[model samples]
Target: MNPSSPDGHYFSPEPSVASDPRVVDVLLDGVDLQLQSDAGVFSHGQLDEATRIFLDGVPSPPAHGNLLDLGCGYGPIALTLATWSPGARVYAIDVNERACDLTRDNARRAKLDNVHVSTPQQTPADVVFDAIYSNPPIRIGKQALHELLATWLQRLAPTGVCYLVVGKHLGADSIAKWLTSQGLRVDRLSSKQSYRVLEVRRTDREQI
Candidate 1:
């Protein structure tokens, strides 16, 4: 999760802090990876607990389809998805340009060409995701978080599913109810360490 910064939040389009890069080692799906991270981004020096739990709880991604790593901070989720599903396209999007750059560099370092790193606006509008995995920015406040989820959740393919890990204290249950009110099916896949893993699917063929 992104901590508050004196200059700006990690969600800022451009962070004001100077870059202090570091390498973060992450083990996902029993595969070890060394990725690049930097200041002014979420979990800069290491994998945050929420993301680690998220990775552990979620199932393997689709073998060949468009996959989305929403709010991808420094490429952990996106890289793992790309690594495991070489046939699939992994889109890693974040509002922070620094985060996007790091994800791009990390993807290159990992030699995963299938991962596409971009800002939310830079992503192609025509593309639809087969699955979306995220540890959403819950601290962005309830309204902004709701808007962000609504925007992307609408982009899910008819049968697409979204797996999100949110802290129970952060209102995971409330978010699930809100998603359901938006005409999506929400299921609690698991809960660990005060975090809830929610599986969201469109209730109908129509866009939510």
Candidate 2:
């Protein structure tokens, strides 16, 4: 673990593990999704705790346009969203190029043609999302992670919402408060492994 990396998780632009990553199967919402992950991606070995909490709280298949998994590690949430909501498209984005590639492979193996995996900069700037889901990278420290979340949360469509998973020990309550103060309606949807699942909605719709 490199102390230089905040979480001792090397999510470098160019990671040292050069060979193609190995494939691993993850169970989400009772469905299996095959993913390829190595050093640079989040939860390289298996499903991370926060994501399990988020998956446990995911209500039902959302009904339309695009659902996004920001900071998607290897397409589990993205693939699950696509699988659950056949009518909607799923976009998986991450900063790690290797992670993006792994997501693409996972989507391909799952036979999901509609799931698009891309780097943060590759997504069209004009695109708006119907819903966003993430098990945020909280260990990156509060301020940086907040900035990351704020950027994507602001991209939600008028009727959109974001589902987030953050551990209580990692300041989930403070984040919920922060989102609420930002004029986004936030609800604590579930609690597991001392993690809080948050549901966020934009406030502008109150006028409608």
Candidate 3:
């Protein structure tokens, strides 16, 4: 697979891998999911630990409204969000074309019509999310990660919230402080297995 970015783990703009589909079976909230994956996507073999932790750590999302699965890899978070909130529109955004293809396929296999897989450039600028979920691409480095998070976090509605999972060694605490300093309210919702689950929202809604 052609490495899209320097760190090189499926943050590619266009992956060189052939359209060979693979399978990943994951159990979210006791529901088993067999998602279509590919060689060039993140955690293509199976669900990654950080994502599993994020899924387990987060509560069921709001019943309705638009939601985002930032840096979606084969649509796990997006599909899960669609399953958990049937009335919501789940946007699965990824920079990798191959990953986007896999995500679209997985959404179809899951029989979820609500999942919209797209690249960052394709997502509407005015679209605001009710909630955002990610096991973010921290390996992309601090500067890029900050830019990515800032871009999406700014798209959060006034009452929107974002659930993110980052490993302790990957600067979870520092990232939280950085987010807070940017005028977002970041709270540690859970810390388990060397991973931190951060709950983020607009500063004005901090008390809400």
Candidate 4:
């Protein structure tokens, strides 16, 4: 098991405090999703710049069956993904209980009962994602961040893909190389404002 975070990593299941609730709404690929937020969580009041860039960079999933919003905070990406793909069942996982509760409530408010919001450990064993999307927490340090990604990358379905947004200064290029070394093909699809949108997949193929 990885060591518990001193930085109060957002992925830590045990949260520090309960933030006051507020609501936020956004349009993603023509779908409008409204979710609640609270203080101290990632992008609590409105969509954070990184996630905004992430959404802007990537197109909506053509088809969604099983999806994951890794480190889903207050359900922005997860809720938007579900709204965009009605056929998808999104597992919104976070370590913060308050964030989890907020996601659950926000999904309920959006009338999207298909989103399963809970802690990382609450996710079932048999679930394999068709798509995994996240604005991964890079401040968590390289080793810890890699561990987080590694745990979930293995959960990708045979043809599944993950969309990630990372700041350029945070070693996004090195991360791509590392993923490539892991046999997961990582493509730097787009870059802007020193941020990168990476698309990763696993296959029986050689490095480029």
Backbone clashes, candidate 3: 0
lDDT of each: 0.91, 0.80, 0.87, 0.81
Candidate 1 accuracy as lDDT: 0.91
Q: What is the alpha-carbon lDDT for the whole of candidate 3? A: 0.87
* lDDT (10s digit) by residue, model 2, range 1-208: 4546543454555555544466677776657777777766777777777777788687985767988999888777888888888788899998877778888988898898889898888998878898999888777677888788888877888788889888888899999988887888999888888988888888785421
**lDDT by residue for model 3 (46-162), tens:** 899899899988989998999999999888888988988889999999998888988898888889899999999999988989999999988788999999998888888898889
Candidate 4's C-alpha runs over 4 A off are 1-9, 205-208
Q: Largest TM-score belongs to which candidate?
A: 1
Provide the TM-score for each candidate, comma-separated: 0.96, 0.90, 0.92, 0.89
Worst 10 residues of 1 by lDDT: 1-10
The TM-score that candidate 3 achieves is 0.92
Worst 10 residues of 2 by lDDT: 1-10
List candidate 3 stretches off by more than 4 Å. 1-8, 17-20, 205-208
Worst 10 residues of 3 by lDDT: 1-10
Models sorted by TM-score, best on top: 1, 3, 2, 4
lDDT of 2: 0.80
